[model samples]
Target: RGGCMGQCWYTAVDTQLYLIAPLLIVPLHYFKDLGKAWLYIMTLTSLIIPGAITNRSLSDHERLYVNETYSTPWCRANSWIVGIWTGYIIFKTGNQLKLKKWQVVVGWTTAFATGWMVMLGMYNVNEHEATTTYIIYEACHRAAWAACLGWVAIACHNGYGGIVNGFLSHPVWQPVSRLTYGLYLISLEVQDDLVKYSRKNLFYFTTLNM
Candidate 1:
């Protein structure tokens, strides 16, 4: 771990095959049983052993090796699975859902609130965090985020997003959105350096740089 701590060449195991695994794992035929697959994937990824593996803090050795071997697809696959299913649903259902205005508003609002709570690290805010809760949160956070975005996508596709769709689809965001894939693949190096040697003044650092 020390040998390659700051080297960009030493890619994390989680990055291994990540660019291609989902392309292979999620099949178009699987969409034929979308509901069943959705339920199974959600339950396995959220309640099974693999879901809890990364929740525990890893030792240096473990971080360098074990995480690569055991945590990659198992721990992260739920997010992809849910996303695939959601896209299928949106494509198949289109505007046929015909949800009421209030329904869309309430559904998206609730999903957004739940996603925010999880994404903001609210579950670990306390000095004494519960292991059980953390495990559940770790397992479910990705699915929760995916679900929230799925709701937004559904609304946008079905013409129910109202203002949200207009804002998100604004032309000003097109260029930035195009860089999303590149950002996801490369930002870790820059972020790693900042976090690894940070001076501990988060507020000042964020204000100055972010």
Candidate 2:
């Protein structure tokens, strides 16, 4: 049953990594500037090298298990690393980096473009069957997404986002943000159950319609 829920193992691994990574990096974090550089290098290398090796070495089933357990973390660690680095920048600069009008346009454009590419890839995954190209995309997409988001954050924090900033900063979103952690914990199970139930009823629904 646990294995039937596709993301259950990944979620469990994610939980452990979230708790343990910071503790392991505490010494590195103490160095401020150097720490940020080290984290950037480490997370980038973690994303690239391991994925390249795994893609070349592992059999399909073995790769799937490795992705669920090992590869997912290496890819996702970028998000945490980027978040910490961006937070530090915001703190030190008081989030005051002013951009040119063109820069703001470029930032938002890149964000939308990369984000939509990720969505498109996921939508087409069955067609691609996690080919080497798709595997590379999966490994690198999150980091690209994170980079785009960092731009969005910079634009929003510095008041360059215009309508985008207004939408993101809306008071209504605050409550939703507050619920994010709880929702994050349970969402995989909810999604799995919903998917299973929907698939089970599909034939019945189709027959009724017919």
Ten-residue stretch with the least lDDT total in model 1: 1-10
**TM-score, one value per model:** 0.67, 0.72
The Cα local distance difference test for each model comes to 0.65, 0.69
lDDT of 2 at 74: 60
For residue 61, give model 1's deviation from the true position in Å: 11
| Candidate 2 error regions (>4 Å) | 1-33, 61-72, 122-130, 200-210
Per-residue lDDT tens digits of candidate 1, residues 18-122? 665455346444655664565565546444544446454533425533444234555556676667668777767877878877897799889879887877865
Quote the RMSD, in angstroms, for model 1: 7.3
- The per-residue C-alpha lDDT of model 1 at residue 145 equals 85
Give the range where candidate 2 is weakest over 10 consecutive residues by summed lDDT. 63-72
Could you tell me the lDDT of residue 28 within candidate 2? 57
Best model number under lDDT = 2
In candidate 1, how many Å is residue 153 off? 0.7
The C-alpha RMSD of each candidate to the native structure, in angstroms, is 7.3, 4.7
